[model samples]
Target chain A: MRAPIQRYRNILDFALSSLLRRKGRNLALICVYTLVIFVIASLIFFVQALKREARELLIQAPDMVVQRMVAGRHDPIPTIQAEAIRAIRGVEAVQPRLWGYYYDPVFGGNLTVMAASDQELAVDSVWVGRGVARSMRVNEGDLISLRGYGGQPILFAVQKILPEASELVSSDLVLMSEKDVRALFNFPEGLATDLAVTAGNPRELATIAAKIVELFPDTRPIMKTEILRTYEAIFDWRGGLMVVVLGSAILAFIIFAWDKATGLSAEERKEIGILKSIGWESSDVLLLKFWEGAVVSLTAFLSGVLLAYVHVFFFSASLFEHALKGWSVLFPRYRLVPALDAYQLTVLFFLTVLPYTAATLVPIWRAATVDPDAAMRS
Target chain B: MASSPMRKSTLCLSLIGVQAALFLVMLLHANAQKDRAIHQRLSSGILVRRLGLTDLCLFTEARYTRHPAMADRHAAFQDHPMGLDHFPSGSLLAPPTFPSPHARTHPAVPEHP
Candidate 1:
């Protein structure tokens, strides 16, 4: 064991010296390698962070959302449907949700107006999201007038501004009392935009959904699990799309790696020849080359991933932020929660480092096995 | 001459150390931020919607089926027909007809055959 360890150390020393000898070429190679990994790693981190955020927030979503459909369009659900759904077995609670979008021409964006649950706001008061308050330039106690469904301007004093951290889901949200929502939207009484249902047993969610559909055919039931799956698929597709867009660059890098591996320069050939002639076995030569490849690839991987971490979590992934996050004049600037999956990291390692290392093996073996005299002559 | 190799080795070692330290610090910071973000989100009552990159594809594919205006408005809703027979007599009260906020020029209720 001691002998093998010593031998491996010697090979690594030689590999390091050889790498240093070609400082200019190796430095350039490392730079390109690191850049490629940085881009890929940043993309992975950004997408995974977004997915994690979605999953965490989705846990709080109602177990099932029931909406009424009429003539192939979502229509307001009758509040009585909530009573019928509450009677369904396995249902723990049912709440009629009053919510709709109010297009604010001033901001050129839609503000989500929802009735505050369990809180009664004064008829003339409203709670606004941080984004809404900033765009509207309204502070607490300031009244902002918005057009109701009747096209009449209604004014409400700002009660509170939601915290900035919660902007991921509530960037354009406005919360008012049920009375205000009905009066503002001219929404009829005894009707709700939708019904949010909670199941007593998570395992009974599917059963409850089916029962709701049976009771109300026009009702559409959206389960929390379904919403999660939709989000996962959506993110996965976007990530896949990015990979496809970067596919050419990745392929170019791979070709460059392959060329460098298989096409040994005259100086490298002479070095191999000298090692083989000096009683160095083919295996030793192979190990020496392996160490060189390992050092370069491992360094590149670490540097790239580290840079990606800073770019995404610290810098908010500025490069891809506009492309991934939707375009909004009043885009809410929120920090992404940094989360790393061990599985994703492992996948990246295999995809980026392993292939290059493996590619070097064939050429290294071929060069190592050559007759020492013939290699020197060439 | 001998000192040159020593200098090179020291430089390489320091580079590796610096990179490793940077990685460790960033990773620790990320984990801490992740925990705080998760705690904040769980306590805050907010529903997940198409907001970020997911929206790019979701909005393009006509796949915003989860939107309030489009939820269950597709073929899935047509698959399960709930005849009037399913409703218990007097269980569902007739809601007063009111103009829908979105129904501008069209009739509030489409005429059913």
Candidate 2:
């Protein structure tokens, strides 16, 4: 038992010496490997985190939304539609939601203005998102003015600023009373932007959606699952696009790794041959190669992942943020929540560490199994 | 330099050990973020539900890119690509979200073709 453990330790020691013998070349290989891993890892982390944020925001979303269409364009559904949907069997509750976009001429950005449902805000009071407040240059006590229909100026006091932590969804959001929204948009009293419907059972969402559509032919019922699936598909495909775009870079890195591993320096070959000539078995040499690959690849992988984590969660993935996360001007600046899932790390390992090790092994095996005299002579 | 065997071994071991320690720090950071996210979501959920929040305000270059589910199928194509030209995210976000099956076909059951 002691002999086997000591033998492996000695091999590990020899591997370290061989690696340091050509420190510059090995260091360059490691740096390139680490960079490739870093870029790929950062993209994966940002996309996954953005997906997670979307999913989290949608958790509180209604089971289904009912909107009316006219001439293939979205139109405000009659508030009376909620009463009609409420009578549907198995429907828990239906709410007529009032929400729309308001273009602020002073700021050149659109703000999402919606009426609070469960809680009633003072008709003249509004809750402003951090983005909205910053853009409008208004504070909690300050007043924000908007031009309504036919150039009717509507002014309201800012009651509160939306929390920054929730900026992912709420940025550019403006929450007001139902009456205020109706007045600001000159919306008819009987009309609403859409209907938020909840079902007693999540499984029954489809049945209820179908019933709503059947009751109102012109009405479009959008299930929450469809919304979730849409987001998942979008994010997954976006990540795929990045991967495809980076495919060439990854291929280049793989080729470089293969060449580096295949071309063992004459000095390295002579050292291995000399070791074999002096009572060292082929297995011992092979084990040393394995250790060398493991150390280099593991170091690169660890540093790459660590740097990516910092880049994404801490620094907001500045390198790839534009491609991955982009809204318009005054968009929310929110840091992604960090998560290092085991599955993600495993996939990354396959992407980075495994390829390098596998590339090294074949070449090293060929060199190790050859005649000591031949390897030294060559 | 591959100077002393003991020194080289220590260097190797310490290099790996320091990397592992840094990784552990990152793991802790992720866990902390997760915990904070859960807390924020709790309060944020209540507010969003009360206000009946719709799609996330992720994009704002155009109406189609802003609300994909509600966007008309032809809206993005109608104006050409200029609407989302400033950002590459438009193309990526365009494919899945733009076509509103809800308004047209409304396929109740997912059909695998």
Candidate 3:
């Protein structure tokens, strides 16, 4: 019978006071929820960043490359395949590339490869990864000796140290003439690892690769886009595993959140009932509890997101502990650049805030709708 | 009243059971590393046989105690030669059409080229 506006106002006032009265319980719930959401958000953020890096590396590479596989091992294609690939329609240029890893003797394996060409790819005439250059303590034109794939000692004069590139696995990369690669590794004439091809149109990449494969059945043609897809799949599998494990923690937090938000002791219920009998309407009691839920959940979610940002950037999500660092020298140590796309952020907010708020209302509504007289009698 | 209390107890127990089940699932998932390693070794063995390549699938615990690195890190499979039955139908390691000039420097390198 009363005006709806008046009811809303009374509900707001009641809700605020009720929440303030039981601040301790709500605070405890906030702490638990924050910890749970923080972990989940950091993982999601870091995995996404890893995928982006892989995609960028792939996009920056040449259009298509041919790698031969024999007996499940990757074998170098004959340097002769360069001509056949270059002859393909829409192919601009075909360059032979040499790739091999050297056991550093001090640390683990350091990978060094020459991106061979008739002409130099970069202005410096050679490209070396920053990690590789840093590890060897070599500058431009500095000589480093490597035991080639053939186990023969070979020397290379560094052209220029390249920027830190995510595409390479090892610290040492050298780009030079195919002849230089052959000379350094003592590799045979017919064998060169792959042919890096530049093409006229990016869209027609798949068609071009298919044609090359048809011609040379022994070789497999891989496009730049395929490289991106492969890395995406690898990261996706790793992220899927992290999700499976943390999914349990999230469920546990939710059950605890629901219980903490909804549950009220018998004494507290009687007090609320007595207050209702005195003057409070059912609507006022409901509003009071609703405010309590919204305030706690929202505060917790915001804090959790901020904490996750710090965890990802400064702490590197503690990924450094096991797979990413001191344990495996193979894994690089890098900060996660969090990608907060609108959809991702929105989903995170709704899943954290709405459920906990709705959970708070269920118990309160049940208690409020009960007859005020029975509350007094009890 | 008795029925109500019994139902409440049942609900509590059911929640506990769900929690236990979830915990067990997590524990099993975490402990599956040993199983995965064994699977990898067995799969590698099968691949060798299917490819028509002959190699000793030396279990590190059983064989090659003297050279720790070879035993631990390097699996002893490359020593055996590929023959008719062990290698698949398509795998043909053709002898070099022209002698590789680089082959002279590294004699230990395989003769596939």
Which parts of model 2 are misplaced by more than 4 Å?
A1-9, A117-120, A151-153, A265-267, B1-6, B77-113
Question: What is model 3's DockQ versus the real complex?
Answer: 0.02
Better of 1 and 3 by DockQ: 1
Error of 3 at A235 (Å): 2.6
DockQ for candidate 1, C-alpha atoms: 0.12
The model with the greatest DockQ is: 2
**What does the i-RMS of model 3 come to?**
18.6
Per-residue accuracy of model 2 over B23-63 as CA lDDT, tens digit each: 88888878877778887677668766776665766766456
Tell me the DockQ of each model, to 2 decimals.
0.12, 0.24, 0.02
**Which residue pairs show backbone clashes in model 3?**
A15-A288, A132-A171, B51-B87, B51-B88, B52-B86, B52-B87
Alpha carbon lDDT of residue A93, candidate 2? 94
TM-score of 3: 0.66
The interface root-mean-square deviation of each model, in the order shown, is: 11.2, 11.2, 18.6
Question: How do the residues B1-113 of candidate 1 rate in per-residue lDDT, one tens digit apiece?
Answer: 44544544455557778887887887688767866786667544433331111111112111132142234423222211111111234126442243222344433332211
Ranked by lDDT from best down, the candidates are 2, 1, 3
Quote the positional error of residue B62 for candidate 2 in Å: 3.2
Better of 1 and 3 by lDDT: 1
Q: For this target, which candidate reaches the highest lDDT against the unseen true structure?
A: 2
Docking class of 2: acceptable
| lDDT of each residue in A185-275, candidate 3, tens digit only | 6778877666778888787788888888788887777676665565565456556666766789778887888778778667667867887
TM-score of chain A of 2: 0.91
Q: Please estimate how well model 1 matches the true structure, expressed as its whole-model Cα lDDT.
A: 0.73
